[model samples]
Target: MSTPTSTDLVVGARPDHLISPHGVLDLRGSAGRDVWLSYPFDAAVVVCGLPGSGKSTLLRAWAASATVVDPRVTRTSFEARMPAWLPYASYRPWARLRHMHWLRGELRRGGPLLIHDCGSRSWMRGWLARTARRAGRPLHMVVLDVGAPEALSGQQARRRLASRRVFALHRRGLARFLRQVERGGQAQVPGISSVVVFDRGQRDRITAVRFGSRPS
Candidate 1:
């Protein structure tokens, strides 16, 4: 991992209004309690991580009421209708397509959106960037940075481990993205306005993600 730079340093206790001028904020090693993040009213927030990283958990904790587009939610809905014996792999493609359709509809709504993504797809980030730019909204990313062992533990806890090959692929992708972020090239993702990085230990410290509201 890249050593923390000056820009990555933690801010004051009240950091609800902090936005890095360089468009990236690293909070992986920050020590704070009840940390809050606030963004614009129409910001497109993308929560990214490995397959087993606690992306879904973080989203539920932070943006429970927002318009969230989560693939897992879509898949669960499909699973609810399918026979118990049927495997999710059997209809993964259809579920993915449905999720994309739902994402498109949510994007067009032009309000605050919290998206759960596996950080492996650059194309999806590009699409989100374009959509945000079109609507004059900011595109922000929240990355859950965890080691393979930690991620695997998370998967085991959730009882949904990804295949070895798939986990390796996602690891590579997330590594590449983090490298770019370290090199200050995250802006190359087109319209990414800001990025907040958090390690596993720092996850629970984030109390909430507030949008278009002043901290109380």
Candidate 2:
């Protein structure tokens, strides 16, 4: 796959800025927060964000663009259409393990795979990093830092109203995940070598970091 052109890196220049027919767009970058972007055809990417922070939007956009870039590449949203075992609060721990196993298996057979979820969870990300290393595939992260206040409001007003139970669960999970990411600041997750901050004005803020390096 070719590198993302200067136009591709710029916001609104591409035909689909937020949600293209081929991909999804993340609007939370309008706020002065970080937005991470992976390589053009990374084998695996974990998109992290709170509810309404536009995780789905970013994943879809990436997926769409990937499809156009390389039809051979398959882009799937594992979190969006989660299996039944993942929803029940009681079985999340076990379900998470199972999901990781499944993801690893998929990567072993993959060309390009993207995992779109609230990957702010340190434990989950650690597991994914290990799995990526074992698979010898490069792992990248796209951290969407839409402040907690906006995320909470978006969840309550839009997400919660749509599905109160799911939204409530997501709310709690998001809070925990954000705290973990903030405390660790990307150092906790191995192989996450780059970060992009999507702030209030600048839509795309890409920064490169070495593996195990902390963001300044």
Candidate 3:
């Protein structure tokens, strides 16, 4: 594995700022406070982070209030029908294809959506950006930032550690993406209009993720 730089491992706390189609908002250093994020009714909110970076945890919370498209949920449903002893690795390709299909359907429907993804694939992000743009809906991203150690600990806690090679690839991809966002170059991400960053501690402070014109 490649050694990670400080910036690649941790994102410093920064105040919110928007440069038209690009915005950087950091949810950190807030104590005893709740954070609420609001967007238009048809916005597509993509939740991204490294493996075991609490992406699943946050998505679970939003599931009740939002239309969430989670790959894990698709995987779980697949597991429900298959034999219990069968490993997920065996049917991973099918599950991924199914997840993508679900995502495409959701994008086509064009309502408020909170999508869970690794944010490591430029092609996937590009496709999403293009689809949202064509539909005349804004695409937003919520990134969960955490160090490798903390992410690994989370994996251990969840008993679902990614393979070292896969994890390294995700780290490299996420690092490159974060570098661009932190540099105020989110416009470089094509149709991604905003990026909201949160460290593990700050992520827990989120009270609700409200969408549309209503107060959050």
Q: Using TM-score as the measure, which candidate wins? A: 1
Tens digits of per-residue lDDT for model 1, 1-216? 122222332332223323332367776766645456667777778999997789988888866647888888899999999999999999999998899888777877777899999877777778878877776677888888977888999999999989999899889988888877777545545588777778877777766777774224
Off by over 4 Å in 1: 1-22, 83-87, 213-216
TM-score of 2: 0.55
Clashing pairs in 1: none
By TM-score, rank the candidates, best first. Answer: 1, 3, 2
TM agreement with the true structure for every prediction:
0.83, 0.55, 0.81
lDDT of each: 0.76, 0.49, 0.76
Give the per-residue lDDT of model 2 (tens digit) for 45-127: 66666666665555555564332121112222334456656654554555556666667776676456667666545666677
Please give, for residues 49-87, the per-residue lDDT of candidate 3 as tens digits. 999999988888887766899888899999999999999
The TM-score between candidate 1 and the true structure equals: 0.83
